[model samples]
Target: MAVTSAETARPLALVTGASSGIGYELARLFAQDGYDLLIAADQPAIVEAKQSLEGLGVQVTALQLDLSKVEAVDELYAAAAGRPIDALAANAGHGLGHAFLDQDWNDIMHVVNTNITGTIRLLYKVGAEMRTRGRGKILLTGSIAGLMPGSFQAVYNGTKAFVDSFSFALRNELKDTDVSVTVLMPGPVDTEFFERADMLDTSVGQSKDKSDPADVAKTGYEAMKRGDGDVVAGLKNKLQAAMAAVTPQTALAEMHRGMAEPGSGKN
Candidate 1:
């Protein structure tokens, strides 16, 4: 971990998956607000993100580590060096496209470990610390996909469902304290996610109109600051989430198939 400074009076925020997309944007918002950042991602791009954020005149510590592994999560927490983590943006996750059974076993587990296991583990560690101090903020990046039964993107959706539900449960458990937890559930966004998830051949992936990541990050960041339980990023996504509440499970799965099935973009 390369830190820009030793320590300071500024509040510290730890943001995971900060290499790019929503995570990077969230870190940028924190920097602009005078928060020092401890940012992590599995890719070398985290280093680049550090340089970019430093231009905002905030100290940034960048760690390149795969959060799916338990050791990595511990390393990230330890990097705090006993300094209080005022906020934690637990945004690290992985996505996979195609039918569940058709996907490789390793790839499937990678998504599970990254999106569910690692996220919860880090939350547990950080949440405990926050509880002890009686203060902190946590923002989780869930998805609208979690509300429905994903057809081709089964494992990814399952992981997000866990995230969305877990965040609410944890928030209620900590309500008496000043600690706050917020979940950001967004629809498709204009990011590298579609390409990385291998969903480019699907209709949802190929669509021209996707929410801007910066905008999505802003929604999440503001909701976190306000201590909201959860927020759906876009109007279209909010309507979809509202409908999922009344729609039958089988119908939701079938609808998802049309959007995420392999090569559905050509239809």
Candidate 2:
């Protein structure tokens, strides 16, 4: 992480998974709005991300670490060194594709840890402090994918299901407080997500049509600022989320399989 002054004169916003994709875009919004940044990601590419954010002229500190570990979250909080956080974008998450039975246990566990455990841990740590401060905003990057049962991408989607549900629960819990929790449930966006999840060969992955990460981030950022409980990133995704509420799980699972099944894109 780049060294900055112990305390930034500007507001501070911490964004995770910020090396690329929606996370990076969210960080840009913060920088543009004159907030100093603390960005973290599991990859070394975060160092480069910091360099780019520096061009935005606000103090930027980047931490490269695996947020899936509880200790890492603690370390991240420690790095903040008592600085007040004005906004938190808890967006670090991973996904796994293919049949659950065939997936490696380690991969499945990683998905659960990164998507669920790490997210809650960060939220709790930051949220507690924010509650005391009486002001803060939180944006959690959940997924429209969570609305349906992912047949081939079982573990990943299951974890997101937890996130989607947890977001609302947390929001309700914080309703009386000044701190706000908003969930961004986006469908597919053109990011490294499909490749990282090893779903590049799937139909959904191959589709040229997908939401732009910048647009999705903007939607979430705006919703968070307004203290809205949640925002689905696209009209199609909003419809999907609505449908999921009434659709039977068994049918949804089959529908997901048609898009995510191995080599489904090749057909």
Which tens-of-lDDT digit does each residue in 55-159 have in candidate 2? 999988899989889999888877777888889999999989899999999988988999999999999999999999999999999999889899999998899
lDDT of candidate 1 vs native? 0.94
For each candidate, what TM-score against the reference? 0.98, 0.97
Candidate 2 local lDDT, residue 85: 87
Q: How many backbone overlaps does candidate 1 show?
A: 0
Number of clashing pairs, model 2?
A: 0
Deviation from native of the Cα of residue 186 in model 1, angstroms: 0.4
Candidate 1: list runs displaced more than 4 Å.
2-7
Relative to the true structure, how large is the alpha-carbon lDDT of every model? 0.94, 0.92
Off by over 4 Å in 2: 1-7
Lowest lDDT 10-residue stretch of candidate 2: 1-10
Cα-based RMSD of candidate 1 = 1.1
